[model samples]
Target: MGLPMPGDSLGDALAHAATLLLEASSVDDTLDAIVRSAAASVPGADHVGVTLAHADGRMEALAATSDLARELAAVQESIGEGPCTFDPDTAGIVHVPDLWHDERWPAFAEVAAQRGIRSKIGVRLYGDSASQAGLSIYSARPNGLDEESVQIADVFAAQAALAMGKARVIDELHDGLRTRQRIGIALGILMHRYSMSEERAFAFLTRASSHGNVKLRDVAAGVVADFVAGLEQPGGG
Candidate 1:
């Protein structure tokens, strides 16, 4: 659904957008909601995109409202220019009111203009020394975005950052629980099969993990798989 009408106060629209963002069920869903909300709420925002930069120097196009947005994000990543490539911690907001005349990012502006995108804006969503994220809005007309659009986008970016951070934490918690359960099951299996105590069974798994240079969870999963495979053999159960 669209955000509150322009006649309504910006505060009211931001409140509504925040509710929608919080209702997202996963990280992907949250990114999608943020882009959709920005497209609907920000004036002159013809398309929107979200890009996440990981600590390992990986760049991901998390979400986009249109192919144009995705293409623009790719251009920014490949050329290492444009607002999306800015340091999120320092460049909280970057605006290109007219792409054709903008010289700050000549290569980026050339590519954008070729794609019929005349204006663009990027708002920092979240950032740390190792990783960062930003939202990009594209327009087809020169001077398409204004200060009002920037203000509205800032609110949306803030809400988006909070939603994304919470989603990541929830995901990490779920992964942790799953890993613990798998390790526990593997320990039980080892203890029963080798007539060893719980501590010894765990130590065995740890040693195997260290020796093989594999993750503990992966080692545990392999043990569980072997047990299941053995059980499936004739007269093995």
Candidate 2:
């Protein structure tokens, strides 16, 4: 089986690709869609790459069009000069177009040239809070990413980033006051029943997630579900 191709024109391609992102049921699905879109939309964009988590600590391309682009982006991310904060150039990472004229990434440039990549464009993925996740796009042609292509890529990046940012804020982040209040009630029960401290109770829940090989949020969700379930029962404590 082959992956779907969106369109011939860049705009049509992006519009089609946007449908995929919109249809995505999860964050990972949306990002994977973006990478595939970039590779397919622009002419000669043989490779595409993107960073995951886009947060401050670490940057990594979750999806890449080729092993070479992926490796280079990771190297730049590892060096810590790339777009941890979302720089427009190189998409907060490293990009090499005519490595002969550009030696920004000495080692990566060598590797890119050896890999036969002549031009590349990296548009950083940003969050609603304006944080960066990663960059995407790569090419084997010398003049692959022209102005129009870059603009189109930027539109794609902005749309995907906005969607992803919204999803993260809703899923991973919460209004702390509300979350703390809801969890505090549940934590209080655990502490009273098990003789644990505030911090210890939270750790116990965290460890339960680790022990069960699940997410802490999943554990918290279960706690809330059980609390709601208990309230429905007769004489529930």
Q: Across residues 96-154, which tens digit of lDDT does each residue of candidate 2 receive?
A: 45654565655555666677766767665654443456655666677766666677777
The predictions' CA RMSDs to the true structure, in order, are 2.4, 8.4
Best by TM-score: 1
- lDDT per model vs. reference: 0.86, 0.65
Q: Candidate 1 regions off by >4 Å? A: 1-9, 54-58, 86-89, 231-237
Clashes of 2: 3
Question: TM-scores for all candidates?
Answer: 0.89, 0.61
How much is 167 displaced in model 2, in angstroms? 3.0
Best by lDDT: 1
Write out the backbone clash pairs for model 1: none
Q: What's model 1's lDDT at 155?
A: 79
Q: Identify the runs in model 2 with alpha carbons over 4 angstroms from their true place.
A: 1-7, 52-57, 78-96, 127-131, 173-237
Which pairs of residues have clashing backbones in candidate 2? 54-133, 82-92, 83-92
